[model samples]
Target: MKQGTGGKIINVASMLSFQGGIRVPSYTASKSGVMGITRLMANEWAKHGINANAIAPGYMATNNTAPIRADEARNRSIQERIPADRWGTPEDLAGPVVFLASQASNYVNGHTLAVDGGWLAR
Candidate 1:
């Protein structure tokens, strides 16, 4: 991007970026840092027409979350907490990712968009 004049930088953050998780102090802190650095990059790179943003996905039924999904009790607890009442799927992120990558989000920068199925709202 720097080699040219403009570009989009989409980073992947996590729900832990916005809140603390059990036994995950380091993970939470690091994801928070991802958000911070994304903002800083936006601040520093905007002049060059670079848009830096992040996506904070909630509980998803992916390889990374296999253990959680396997534990029926924990899975139920999480699903109940989310207004959507289910774990997010990788497919759920398609639209947001597309928007951020497209000119539709030209004015959006340095923001962490949550694809959490209303997890944060609850």
Candidate 2:
């Protein structure tokens, strides 16, 4: 974006970015860093027409979460915590990702959009 063509920089953060999770200190720290740096980038690059932001997903059903999902108790507990009463699917992210990547979000910058199905809200 330094060349001024303008661009979008979408970084992936996590619910851990906003809160600490058990047994994942490194992951939590990194995700928090992602959020901080995304904002920093927006502050530095927005003037050049570069929009930097992040998306934080909560309790997603993905390969990486297979272990958690496999544990019936854990899965149930997680589901109960989310206001949506379910784990987030990859498809749930499509709209937010598209919005962040499109001109529709041209005025959006330095924001971390939580596609967490209201997990954070609770």
Candidate 3:
């Protein structure tokens, strides 16, 4: 990006980055690394007009979580935990994505915005 037109790089992280839950060692480590990398890259490339940031999303009902969502008890448990009273949909994430990709976020860098429906607060 340094040699080309410098732009924004949005890293999609997970809620796991902020807190470690049960039975997911590798996931926790990987997400922690993502937060680190986002900060490092932002600092390194800021002078070149390149912004790097991360978005940490909570439990969303996507293709990757199909198996988990398929189980009745597990799915219910997940929803009950979320303050929003439901799983997040793809549409729930679009606004933040658009803001990050647009000029409105020009001053934002190395920040991890959470779109977790107040999951962290709970």
Candidate 4:
């Protein structure tokens, strides 16, 4: 994007970026770094017409979490915490991604939008 002098950069972060989630300290740290770097990029690159942002997705029913979903206890614990009362689907991210990339969110830069089902509110 810097070389091109203008572009949209969308990064994938996680709810862990804001919280010290259980059992995966490294994951939490990595996501936090993603959040920081996204903002740094936005600050430096917005002048070049580059919009750098991140999406912090909550628990989703993707294969990446297949094992956790397979485990009854872990699955129940996560669903209960989410006000949505169910796991999020990949489709849930469609709108947010579109907005970030489209002119609709042109003014939105360096923002890490949490697509959690009110998980952070709890």
Q: Give the Cα lDDT of each candidate.
A: 0.93, 0.93, 0.90, 0.94
Query: Candidate 1's residue-wise lDDT over 1-122, tens digit each?
Result: 64876999999999899898889889999999999999999999988899999999999889989998999999999899999988999999999999998999999999999999999997
Please state every model's RMSD to the true fold in angstroms: 1.1, 0.9, 1.6, 1.6
Clash count, predicted structure 2: 0
Q: Is candidate 1 or candidate 4 better by lDDT?
A: 4
In terms of lDDT, the poorest run of 10 residues in model 2 is 1-10
Q: Write the per-residue lDDT of candidate 4 for residues 19-75, one digit (tens) a residue.
A: 987889889999999999999999999988999999999999999999999999999
Candidate 2 at residue 98, lDDT?
A: 94
Candidate 3 residue pairs in clash (backbone atoms < 3 Å): none
Quality of model 4 by C-alpha lDDT: 0.94
* Predicted structure 3: lDDT: 0.90
What stretches of model 2 exceed 4 Å from their correct place? none
lDDT per residue for candidate 3 within 12-54, as digits (tens), equals: 8889989985899999999988999999999999888999999
lDDT sort, best first? 4, 2, 1, 3
For candidate 3, give the lDDT of residue 110.
Answer: 95
The regions of model 3 sitting more than 4 angstroms off are: 1-5
What TM-score does candidate 1 get on C-alpha atoms?
A: 0.95
Cand. 2 Cα-lDDT: 0.93
